[model samples]
Target chain A: MIRFDKISWSAGSFALEEVSFAVPAGSYAVLMGRSGSGKTSLLEILCGLRTPSSGSLWIGDNEITSLSPGERGIGYVPQDGALFPTMTVRENIGFAQRIRGEPAAATKATVGSLAERLGIGAVLDRRPQNLSGGERQRVALGRALASRPQVLVLDEPLSALDEELREGLARLLKDIQRDLKLTTLHVTHHRQEAAQLADHVLRLENGAVVRESGPPQNG
Target chain B: MTLRGSRWFWGLLAGITGAYLAFILAMLAATAVYSAPSDLWKALQSREIQHSIWLSLCTCTVTALLSLFIAIPSGYVLSRATFPGKSWVQAALDIPIVLPPMVMGLALLILFQTWFGRLLEKAVALTYTVNGVVLAQLVIGAAFAIRTMHGTFDHLSARPEEVAMTLGCSRARAAWLVTLPAARRGIFAAGTVAWARSMGEFGPILVFAGATRMKTEVLPTTVWLELSVGNLEAAVAVSLLMVVFAMIILVAVRRVGERV
Candidate 1:
């Protein structure tokens, strides 16, 4: 579960004012807003990439406001996938484990398994530059799940893909969330995606949550 | 006819420039080969020449390593963070590069001869010593390194380091593992240029370290010394050696830069 209570942050003229939301455990929550609605900012705040001026953030039982991004146990995949171009897909996927001092052999096994599950086993040796848009997204998703965090925060993950690829990945994401029972907070402006994938929806305007819909897809 | 004429004109222009570049290269090659076997060999066997070459290599290697160690962090901070006086710091880093080498040496000598010199001499000697040569080379070489690395760090987005940090690596660790690896080619090129600059340094070594045979003498200083003593053969040999080393380093840097 994830909860934000009265989170406020100011960057120059842009401000996230009194924002709040809650996502239940093992559910997909999509946040929809136009550009400059602080949707990315909210996700960044939850991921601990940006600090809120005031308010509390809770991931499960832990108050994550004081924690660093890594300590928050939240996997954040940015808009562009942000995969290291120099690293092979296998290496990129295993980066979180490598950072945490996991043994090389163990990391290899884990990454191999994740790649197989993501159907990216064949491209494991290739670099991110060589991967197609959908393939990159899958590799990025695999990388995020490598650490097995409490929640996954995806910021416009499907926005960069073409129409055909985005639709396929959207369904794939829903399937992954259901199969893994992973709690996910997906940020996007695409209402159709929200309609299809989200268990619930929160609309943001001027940095504040203005509306909430319950289990849109489940109904 | 018009299209063919334009194409011919462009091709001719390219060919002319290529021929001029090839002519300069041929001259350098001829000078190296002609100086190598007899004059260069005899100079290489001399104790003074051997000592100067050794000193040059040792000082250049140390300067290159030290400059890289310092430049990496400096470049990262300048590239990644915003702080007060950032522009001033950047401008200061470039000062040594633009200063004339002889002026740099003179300034170093004057600073060392003042109260600063006495203070440093108390701790460790500076003026007219091997350390002085190393210090001069370091000052110039580090500037070259920082300039190269600053461009490199600027070219890279900070996203990789940020991602590494989110993956449980500390800031320093992220810099080491991700940022440095991403800029590896740039770093290598910087080190090569720094070492080459140090090896070819003449004015700074002569002014600060005083061209002492078998003591503080480096390759360029040895060439200068041989010329002063009317040993034209030995001077030509040392110059040829320095030119060869510089060419090798430059070629390697170009190859690495292309790959990166």
Candidate 2:
């Protein structure tokens, strides 16, 4: 489970105040909000990219508010993948394992398997600059899953793609989530995307949270 | 006979560029022609000239490296963080670059005469020594280096390093493994700027380090010493030598771009 308790944060003139919500384990929660509606700020709080002024973040029963970003056990895929340009896709996928001092052979095996699963096996030796948009997103997903994180937070992961590619990758995401039983919070403003993915929905408007069990009704 | 808008634009641009190049070549030609070939050879072979060449190379190289020591962290913080008085701190870095080099040299001379400076001097003399040569060069060199590094860091996005942190790498580790490698070209450019600036530095060294024979004499001071004694040939020859060094460094920086 992933939860934000009474999260209050203000930056410059924008603020999200005392926002509270939860996404159950092994389920997908779509956070829907329009532009300038604090969705990215809320996502940043969940991913440890920003700290809420008066709230605690919980991931699978652990209070992670005091943890540094690296220790928070959240795997985040930012809007454009943000892959390390210095490393090949293989290295990018295996970064978590290598960082934790996993044996080289095991990291290599994990990278190989994950690349195959993500359908990026052929491009494992290439850098992100050479990747197509879909391929880059897949490599980013592989990188996120390598650490076996407690919660997955994706910020507009499919927003960059064309219509066909977005639909295809949306299916891939659903399948992977179901296969791994990973709890997730995917942020997007698109109503159809929320309808396609959310087992639960949280809507943000003027910095408040409103929860619904399924796709939102027309505004 | 006729030119369109694009043609006229290109022709004017080329004309201006050619005029500038011609002026520079004329300056070099004048220096090259001022002295006989034998006198130039003798200047190269002279013990004082050779010593100044070695001293200039060693001091400038040392000054460039030390500037990086000051520049990298200062640039990184200045680029990345926002704090109280941040703008003031950034403006302070430009002080050395904006001030006359002779003023900076005078400041150093005045500084060493103070209590804290005297206490520092007890450890390593910097008033009129080879160490002073590096110190004088460093004040100007580091300012340029810091600005270069600041621009470099500013252009690079912080998103990749943040992603590394999410992947179980600590902030410091992320910087080391991700940000630094991406900034390699910038670091090289910063070092090149510092070295080139230090190579041409004269006013600071002449004011602070003093032009003692075979002691603190660098290429610039060699020029000054030659001119003061009315040895115009030796002065012009040393000027030519400095130009040759600049060309070599230019080629070297370009090679770094291609290879590294």
Candidate 3:
């Protein structure tokens, strides 16, 4: 489980006050908020991209507040995918493994299997610039999973996709989550996406969680 | 003729200007090439000339590498972090670029003649040595590298490095593996420019290292020495060599820039 307690942070004119939440293991939680509602900030803090002014974060049995981002074992996928343009898709997927000092042969096999499962095997040689929005998102998802993270945090992963692509990608994401059985925190303002993908929903307004909805199936 | 004729005339005029500029550049290239071969042979055979060229290349390469090593972290910090006096730090990094080279050399000389130089000299002599030439080049070359790299890092989104960090790479490792690869072309271009800047450095070497022939004498200093002794051919030879190296660097930078 991933938990944030009494998190407070101020960035310029924006402030997040007393934000608290927990995402249970093997559950998909969606953070729903309008633009400028501090969703991105919350996501950043959770992923260790930014620190809370005051708060405690816990992942599993570990208090992650004192740990660096690298030590937190959280997988983050930014809104734009943020794929390294210089690296081929295969290399991009295997990046985290390389960082963790995984054997090159093992990394290659792992990336190949992931890419095949993600349906990006054909474009493994291409760079991010050549990949479509849907394809790039898949590669990003594959990269995050390659690390076998404790909690996967995705920031607006579908915002850049077209209507035709978003629905299919959402389903793909659900299937992947189920297959990996990984706890996931997905941030998006889209109500449809939140309703479709999340097991539970936390609605943010001006940086505070105003409403916490029960599991989507219960609703 | 209609309005279209006037537009065509403007286009023709622009083309003519471009042609003229190209012609002038070609002429300069021709002059350098014409003087290079014969003079270069004589200079190359001379032990003094060989030593100066070797020293210049070695010092500049070391300076470029050191400058890049330091500049990468500094540039990333300036680009990605928000700290007190960040703007002031940026301004300080850029100060050397706009300052006249002679002024930079003078400042170095002053610092060397004072407590800092004595401290370094106590461990290893800095002034009037090969090391001094390398140090002088690094000071200026690193400024150039940082200025170029700062923009490169700034233009890139920090999301990739953040992703890397979250995946268990430390800040330094994330930068080296993720951020550095993303900005590889920019860093390469910056290194090229820094190497060229170090190679052509005259003012700093002249003041700090005192232009000792075959010892601290870099290519530019050798050129100056040749010119002072009425050896125009030898002077032009060294200048032409510098120009060739500069051209190679420029082409390489252009190619890398295009790729990025």
Candidate 4:
């Protein structure tokens, strides 16, 4: 479970005040907001990228407001995939393991399994620059999942795709979320995506969570 | 019509610039061939010329490598960090580029004459030594390298390093693993440029290191030494050697810059 209690952040002319919410364990939550509404800021705060001006965050039993992103056990996929342009898909997926000095064989196994699960095994040798939009997103997903974190945070992973590709990846994401039972916080502006994939939805306006909804109907 | 007027006008301007470069290259080649192969071969075999060539190669290599060691972290911080007096620091870095080489050498010589230099000289002498030559070359070479590296890191996104940090690497570790590898092309370009600049450095070495034969006689000073002695053939030969060395380095720089 991920919970934010009375979270507030202020910078320059923008402020997000008393934004409180929770995602039950093993459920997928979508955060919807217009541009400049602080949805990305909220997600950033949760993943330890940005510290709240005043507030506390808890992931399951751990109070993560004091922890670094690496210590918080959160996997984040930023907008545009942000895959390391110089690394092959396999190296990108295996990066966390490599940094931690894991054995080469072990790192390879982890990368192989993640690539297979993400259906990106065929393109493991290719660099991020060579991959298509969908392929790049999938490679990014495999990289994030390689570390096996409890929370998966995605920032508009499908916003750049075509309508047909978006629908396909959305279904694939929902299926993967269910299969892994990950506590996920997905950010997007598209309500149709929220209705399609979210077990719960929260809409933010001007830095506040203005609405919350129960799970969407089964397909 | 545009200020540039037409394609023909631009082509003519470009052709003039290209002709000037061709003329300079032809002049160097003509001078080199003015003397017979036997004369060039005899000049090359001179013990002083050989020693000067060897000294130039060693001192410039040392200076370039030392400059890179300082440039990498200095460039990264200058490019990526925001701090008090950032503009002041950047202005200080530009001094070597803007300062006259003779003035820089005079400054170095004065520094070595100070109490601090007197203390240092007790243990290891710097003035008029081969080590002084390396120091003189490093002063300008490192400044150029730092400029290139700073530009390189500025162009690279901070997102990759942030992502690496999220993946459990500390900030330094993230930079080492991801940022440095991604910046390989920039590193190569900086190193090559610094090496070439060090090889061509003259004024500072002449003033600080002093052109003592077989001691501080680098390729450039060798040409100077030959000219003062009225050995026109020897001076031309050294000049030709410098041209050849510069040509090789420029070619390497071009290849690396393309990749970057």
Candidate 5:
């Protein structure tokens, strides 16, 4: 479970005012907003990338408001994937483990499994620069899942793809979330995506959560 | 086939570039040709030349390494962080690059004459010593390194470091694992340029370290000493050696840069 209680932030003229939401464990939450609506900022705040001006954040029962991004136990995939350009896909997926000095065999096993699951096993030896947009996203998703964090936060992971790829990945994400029972907070402006995958939906306007909806039935 | 239109225009520009290259090569060739092999051989075997060559190599290596240590953090801050008087800080970093080498040397000399420098000197002698040579080279070389690394970090997005942090690496680990590795090519380029600049530095060493024989005497100073004593052949030989060595290292570095 991920919870934000009365969280607020101010960056220049933009502000997130008293935003609050909760994603129950094993549920997918979609945050919808127009451009500059503070959806990304909210995601950043939740993942400990930005400090909240007030209030608290919690992942399950643990209060993580004061923790650094690394200590927050949140996996964040940014809007552009932001894969390390110098590292191969295999290395990129295994980065979190490698940095923590996990055993080589374990990292390889984990990375191989994750890549195979993400359907990016063939591009393991290639760098991010050599991968297509969709391939990069899969590799990035694998990287984020490598550490097995408390929650997975994706910022517009499917927005960059073509309609055909987007639909496929959206379903893929749902399957991944359901199979792994991964708590997910996906931020996007696409209403259809929210309808397709979100177990709960929240909309943001002017940096505040303005609406909430229960899980949508199958389309 | 007859060249026409933009082809001639580009050819003209290429001709100008070729002229510049030919001019530099001819000047060096003339010096090398005028110097007798026996004279060049004698200069190479001289104890003073030997000492100067070794000193230049050692001091420049130390200077380059020292510059990298300072540059990494300095460059990251200069590139990534926002602060009051940032423009002023950037300008200060660039001052060494623009200031005359003699002025820099003079500044160092004046600094050592002050109370602070005197206190430091008590800890370890610097003025007119080989250490002074290293210090002088570091000042300018670090400026080059900082500039190179600043641009490098600027060109690279900071998102990877943020991603690393999200993956449970600390701030330092994120830099060590992601950002620094991403900037490896730039680091190599910076180090090579700084080393070359340190090797060729003369005016600062002349003023601050005083070209002392068998002590502070670097390659540039050795050339000066030979010329002063009317050993034209020896001076020319040393100059050729420096040119060749610098050329080889620069070419190797460029190739490595290209690969990256």
Candidate 6:
């Protein structure tokens, strides 16, 4: 579970005021908002990349507001993937486990399996710069899942893809979320994307969660 | 709206660039033609020339390594951090670069006479010693290296390092494992430029480290020594040697750096 209580932050002249919301355990929540509506800032704060002026952040029953990003046990996939350009795709996916001093065999195994599962097995040895947009996004997803965190935060995971690729990846994302049963907060401005992947939807407007609703019955 | 709309505009730009290249090449060519290959060959065999060449190479190498050692941290800090007086700090770092070579040498000459320099000299002699040659070159070389590093770090995105942090690595590890490796090309470029700058250093070495035969004398000092004695042929030969050697090393470094 991921929860934020009374989160308020001041960035330049813009303010996120008294924002409170929760994503229940084993559920996918989509936070929808227009550009510059503080959606990215909220995700950044939750990922521990930035700090909220006044707030408490909880992940899986533990208060993680004061913890470092590495200690938060939260996987974050930023908009551009942000892969380490010095390494191959295989190495990028295996980064967390390698840094944590996991056995080489186990790390290699995780890289191999994640590569296959993400349908990027053919490009494991290739660099991020050489991959297609959708392939890069899958590499990023595999990288985040390699750490096996209890919560995941995605910022515009499918915004850069074509309509067909976007729909295909949306279905893949939903399947992965269901299989992992991990609490998730995906930030996007696409209403169709939200309806397709979100079990619950939270609308952020004017720096607050103005509405909450379940997916459409047909969806 | 477009600079290329007129063909004369492109021709004008290319004209000045070609003229500049021609002038520089002519200067180097004049030096090469002044001494025949045989005179250059004979001068290269002289003991003084040999000693000066060896001394210059060793000092320049040490100066390059030290420049890199200091440049990395200084560059990283200047690029990434915000402070109360950042502009002033940047200006201070530029002092070595902007100071006239003679003034820098005079400052170093006086600095070694102070209490701290006296203490340091007791450990390893710098004033008028072979090590003093390195000190003089480092003053300017490190300044250039730091500036290069500062720009290099500035151009690199912090995104990769941030992602590394989220991947459970500390900030330091992320820099070492991600950022530094990514900066390999910049490091090579900085080191090569520092080494090249050190090879050409002349005025500072003359003022700080006196030209002592087979002792503190570097190639630039040897040039001065030869000119002082009115050995015009030898002086021109050594000058030409410095140019040729500098060119060869520069081309080699560029190739190796590109491969890396």
What C-alpha lDDT values do all the predictions have? 0.87, 0.89, 0.86, 0.88, 0.90, 0.89
Kindly report the docking quality category of candidate 6.
Answer: medium
Model 3: per-residue Cα lDDT over A18-43, one tens digit each: 88878888889998888888888888
Location of the lowest summed lDDT over 10 successive residues in candidate 5 chain A: A210-219
Candidate 5: tens digits of C-alpha lDDT, residues B48-153: 8999999999999999999999898999999988899999999999999999998999999999999999999999899999899999999999999999999999
- Residue B136 of model 4 has an lDDT of 91
Better of 5 and 6 by lDDT: 5
Predictions' DockQ, in order: 0.60, 0.77, 0.71, 0.63, 0.71, 0.72
Task: Please list all clashing residue pairs in model 3, or write none if there are none.
Answer: none
Ranking by TM-score: 2, 6, 5, 4, 1, 3
Candidate 4 lDDT (Cα, 0 to 1): 0.88
Q: Which regions of candidate 1 fall more than 4 Å away from where they truly are?
A: A102-109, A212-219, B1-23, B26-37, B113-119, B256-260
User: Tens digits of per-residue lDDT for model 6 on B1-260?
Assistant: 57556777889899999999999999988888888788878888999889999999999999999999999999999998878899999999999899998899999999988999899999998998888999999999999999999999999888778778888988899899999988888888888778989998988898899888998888888888888998877888889878887888789777987887
- Residue-wise lDDT of candidate 5 within A87-202, one digit each (tens)? 99999999989878899999999998998888998999999999999999998899999988879999999889999999988998999999989999999888999999998888
Ranking by lDDT: 5, 2, 6, 4, 1, 3
lDDT of 1 by residue, A74-190 (tens): 877888888887899999999999878889999999998999888899999999889998899898889988988889889899998988889988998899889888899999888
lDDT of 4 by residue, A83-135 (tens): 89889999999998887789999999998888887788899999988999999
Candidate 6's residue-wise lDDT over A1-219, tens digit each? Answer: 788889999867999988988888888999998899999889889988888899799887799999988999888888888888889999999999999999999999999988888899999999988999999999999999999888989999999999999999889889989998988899998999999998888889888885468733221
Task: Give residue B247's lDDT in candidate 4 (0 to 100).
Answer: 91
Per-model i-RMS: 1.2, 1.0, 1.2, 1.2, 1.1, 0.9
Cα lDDT of model 2 by residue, A1-219, tens digit: 888889999988888889887888878999987788998888888777787899888887799888888888888888999999889999899999999999999999998888888899999999999999999999999999998887788899999999898898899899989998999899987788888988988888878878866643321
Runs in model 4 with CA error above 4 Å?
A6-20, A103-105, A215-219, B1-6, B9-13, B16-20, B256-260
Off by more than 4 A, model 6: A11-18, A215-219, B1-6
Q: What TM-score against the true fold does each predicted structure earn?
A: 0.88, 0.95, 0.87, 0.90, 0.90, 0.93
Candidate scoring better on TM-score of 3 and 4: 4
Q: Whose lDDT is higher: candidate 1's or candidate 6's?
A: 6
